[model samples]
Target: MTDTSTSSVPESTADATAAEPEATTAEETADGGTERPAADNKDLFRESEIAADYVEGLLDILDYDGDIDELTQGGRPVVEVVGARLQSLVGQRGATLEALQELTRLAVFRQTGTPSRLLLDVGGYRASRRKELAAVAKNAAEKVKQYGEAIKLDPMSAFERKCVHDVINALSGVESESEGVEPSRRIVVRPAS
Candidate 1:
């Protein structure tokens, strides 16, 4: 039987989902048989499919309209929901979006019996946030280089800290480190020397 749920979704979303590689694995199975790498790719795509369905259901329940795109990037499943007037789901600094992403990950885990490194984007929020965080990271790195001292930034999520760390590590005269605990964990930029 064919699934009719996607009938209402936009054609762009359908195309995006179709564009992902089928899942397959490269490891040997318990039966001493080599599994195809395509299996892993298919698994990742399946995770995206599950995540997309969950997110679509959520949008429907909330009376929100969006074009959902499910695809794999950087070896991980990514689901993107794009639409107008969807800011409420994104919340302040995308806190709500983060929560929803975790929920979708859990859903994938429950279905696939494997933990998912799924990334969910709502209303292009993550892309915008990444750009903003990159700028913040550069500024912090600059401050460290100019002051010749350690600079502690405001606490940020793990993803945000990673962004800053990547920027600082790429620079010549500065390094970045994470300190403190969750919700309070932040990045510290220090002179390389």
Candidate 2:
């Protein structure tokens, strides 16, 4: 495990907010994608700090040893916990991880008074799961294209479905959609008309 002392843990939320530099107006990139306003980035960073503190407290209460890192990713606050024996926090099929993420987002919202798209990851579960889901999406897309019929994937969480949809949407000859309700919602890949 890496030394937690050297991690970029935020000292305090106030310090984090106070240290933000003045931001200019959003600028368009060469690719036509607009950069987020610096103040918005600062707010996202603050959300991450608040979430990191909440996770640190939870880890302390649980007597768990892990190194937590907080950062902004894809325009949202992300907190990642890395260390040994952290699988319980991830739980089976990432159910516990999802619940923890929601709680962390709630913590950020309670402090910031705004909804947060905070993503909490434990033991790199999300990164690995994304790879797996991408493969599943590819396989489903291939089957749909080959058979010229819709292929229904097993029920998946919102995050998992999004991963699958992203992969499927990028490929040609096939499209994907979600169906059903929570805990049972699934994706269907079909040949594009």
Candidate 3:
């Protein structure tokens, strides 16, 4: 397993982790909107390193060969695994991937004592899924606009729902909202009033 760092390494992961909690405290801004200090790049990079190490260990135990990339993207730690014959890690509808991501986040939290917003992607599944979800959102929006009625989408994961919501929000004439609970949560698109 190879680890790649996209940002400058901190003097110590421990030092970065220790300073994270204080930076996360919410404070009122001039406009009355609550704001929190942006996570330091070093801290975020350390999170990616931790997550990558955890994932590397799992791959070793499973005897899988893959290249792991660790980096920070959009203010969150991201780990991407790219290789052949890794479909099992991705699982059906990315269920296993999501589970693994949560496990990786837990590993980071155990060491840092702070929750991590870590994104783990296997075999480019998320990128392709995002495109598919965008098409689904556009189709649903079209149906709602034409029929002047609501269109209910199938149950989806939070990531999938967010993708759909993004597309719906970018388009006109339709609005979207999520309803139901986990494992059954879905998005509904309706003609904007």
Candidate 4:
């Protein structure tokens, strides 16, 4: 799966769910799953703890403080930092946040020796932007169905394009593909092959 750092596919696995801090240590199951002290999944929370520690170090270096909440949602580690004046952390359509999330995940990978599915949110920007992009994707799908002409969205980050691709693919009459290169890459919706 593409690393859409600011995104969630919205299926909360039974193996993992959301939670706040104040955790109890856990051990691995015979099936290689981590058992949670709480009803929530421990593996995801474990990943989030690792991620939060990494982010907290960066925060200390930058002298920034916010509420860091680590939870496992959608079978992934989600770390949310919420506070004032952090929109710059999001960059233009969250490009900077995505890069930071990648870097942070790399930090986790170094520690665990396995790639992580970490979702980093600073501010509530991603939720808001996702709604806006869903609308855009819906509109584009309607256009594709109506005219049968190819429609290309403006250059978007990889995450944004993935959101668009999912929306278009779910519709009946059209399909989507990413074309071009980073910083100028985009999505194209067309008749299904």
Candidate 5:
């Protein structure tokens, strides 16, 4: 029901923005010199704007009521939809939400002619899932430490595996690795040698 744009640069952040052209430009340097665009670093706000518009249209089509907020986090564009009765958009284990995120990224790519790594969250699914995954990672790490043996976890989505890997990497006496192919990819936590 509401759309928020991150396109406008607040006057307060103007100085920081001027000092960091990489945050906006595709390739060109701050001094207008030549440089290949940072493939992982593009115009974050613009990406958010494009993704927000796309999600807003989707909401309208589904007759859904939600407040959409778009912004950049950790150098990646993020779109969050907040509203009651939005569980269906999240689907089972966020399958639908993941599909919708890819579609939104495609929409951004079509407009900007660049691939987008935009992340979409419906009803705080990702945030909650991250917490849950963190717990899972910690528990697995504990098991590996206690048993002093390698432990293979169930297959997980890329996002889930990434979350687990991040958490496991931070723990001592444990390391993690991914094996298998798509849809069957999983993480293995083992005691450090």
Candidate 6:
């Protein structure tokens, strides 16, 4: 395990809203100017730290070894666990991993009194899944282009939708959108106008 502290964790532009005022409450300053406390972006970094510690404990308990990388995406911190033969951490259809992600988020929320959107990727499962989703997206784009009709895909997690969106957006003749809520939300590929 790396001895890096939370202070050393890298922050993306989206993660560090340091210049923004706290959204909790409005107050007057000594000069009679209305302002709020500095927003505690620390909570997000805390979330990643707490999540890392949790996953580390899990790995230790399971006698599994992995290198964890902490990062930020779209304003949320993420933890990626990389190791060999760690597919079980991903679970069947990623159900177990999703559940664990929620648990890790909850752990962060409990400590910071703020909800978190942390993403946890185990054993490069997400990278492989991204490739697969990209292929599905490309295929759907082809069908849409050929048929001149929209193609609705199976319900997918937000991650899958993002992968498809990226793929479709990169193509010359297709577009896509997420059309539902979590657990059943999916994407629709359509011919570009």
On lDDT, the candidate that comes out on top is 3
Candidate lDDT (C-alpha), each: 0.66, 0.69, 0.72, 0.64, 0.68, 0.64
TM-score winner, 3 or 6: 3
- Which stretches in model 5 have alpha-carbon errors above 4 Å? 1-42
Number of colliding residue pairs in each model: 13, 0, 0, 0, 0, 0
lDDT of 5: 0.68
Off by over 4 Å in 1: 1-39
Query: Candidate 2 residues 65-107, lDDT tens each?
Result: 9999999987778899999999999877776887788788789
Cα RMSDs, all models: 14.9, 13.9, 13.3, 12.0, 14.6, 14.4
Write the number of the candidate with greater lDDT, choosing between 1 and 5: 5
The TM-score ranking, best first, is 3, 2, 5, 1, 4, 6
Write out the backbone clash pairs for model 3.
none
- Tell me the tens digit of each residue's lDDT in model 6 across 43-85: 5567788899888988998999999887765456788999887
Ranking by lDDT: 3, 2, 5, 1, 4, 6
Candidate 3: segments with Cα more than 4 A from true spot: 1-37
Candidate 1, 8: how far from true, in Å? 40
The prediction achieving the highest TM-score against the true structure is 3
Candidate 3 C-alpha lDDT tens digits along 52-142: 9999999999999999999998777899999998999988777688779879989999999987878899999999988988888887888
Q: Per-residue lDDT for 28 in model 6?
A: 14
Candidate 1's residue-wise lDDT over 36-143, tens digit each?
234367889999999999999999999999999999986678999999989998876666776787789899999998767787888888788777777877776676
Let me know the TM-score candidate 3 reaches against the reference structure.
0.80
Point out the higher-scoring one by lDDT: 1 or 6: 1
> How high a TM-score does candidate 2 get?
0.79
